[model samples]
Target: MNILVSDFDGTLTEHDFFELVRRRWPLPPEQDPWNQYWAGEITHFEALARIFAGIRSRPGELEAMAEATGLDPNVGKAVQNLKDGGWEVVIASAGCGWYIERLLKNAGVAVKVHTNPGSIGSQGELLMTLPYKDKFFSDTTGVNKLAVVQDAMERAERVAFVGDGRPDLEPALLVPPQLRFAHGWLAQELEARGESFQPFQHWSEIAEILTRC
Candidate 1:
């Protein structure tokens, strides 16, 4: 099997949940868990959990905002193209799967996904939890990206990884440099490390490059 492992947040969508959540509920700097995360005082999972839990929106506001977020029109086509070429695509995300699943369903594509499970509280707070017993679960970030990629590599004849965040750096580096793809933070890091990788703007571009190989 040929595996395509990708990230779900900014890597797949035009915006990340943090960006949208912050736009709606910008916590004060002193109270922001993100500050703790950057300062090494908290875990990535704790940071996101606190951020979402801090939101006190009306019953349906958050849902509506999530539903209205736009995904690339070519995403479904890209998944199809990769599948047609015998690639098994899987998503590994440190973010909540609540909106990720909804967005993918709205896009009309189905593929394997692994992310932190979450639910919206009756009062509007989004509660996320780690998959405690999963093989790839992590206490620090909710999801251990490197484990996911390693699991895929165990079954795959060839593996390709794509991502765009700090959490993605390790896994992106685990894959062969030739099959690694990066954008945003991941891209800048890869460049600084002098690692060779494909830089892409859209999921469709990745599909084209992967299928051509």
Candidate 2:
């Protein structure tokens, strides 16, 4: 059996949701932890924890923000087609589970999703919970995407990964070149690293690739 692991955010949607949040809730340059993460001074999860600390809103507001983000129109159909073709589809994301689930549910796509758990705190701060805290790398993204992909690999005859960001890097690298699909920033990164991947811009492209395999 073939297992398809896909990233959310820019991979499934047209824009990066984490970036959208950062933009919508701009922090002062001196206070932006994301800058540290970008500069390799901190872990990804630490950056996220810091970023979420600045966000003060209700769950509904966050949901609205997720809903407003545009998704690939063909995603739902593509997922269904993959399922029909006997593939087990899973969304492996570094983004917040609440937001990812809301976005997919709103889009009418049902699939197993793994991501950092998030919630609106009593004071309205967006709080995120990391699952595998002990396994975090120095770049700690909180979400153990490599472990997720590795687990999938153990369960399937073959595993394919589709993604478009920094969080997708390690997991994508775990898969063979032919079984990895990357685009946008991820594509650029892979190219710069001289790694091979199937570059894509739409879900149809991914669906086509998985169908053939």
Which candidate wins on lDDT?
A: 1
Please give, for residues 68-159, the per-residue lDDT of candidate 1 as tens digits: 55567788999999999999999899998888888889888899888888998877899988888767889988889999999998999999
Clashing pairs in 2: 44-139, 45-140
| Model 1 stretches astray by more than 4 angstroms | none
Q: What is the lDDT of residue 48 in candidate 1?
A: 93
> What TM-score does structure 2 among the candidates reach?
0.88
Q: How many clashes in candidate 2?
A: 2
lDDT of 1: 0.87
lDDT of 1 at 76: 94
TM-score on alpha carbons, each prediction: 0.95, 0.88
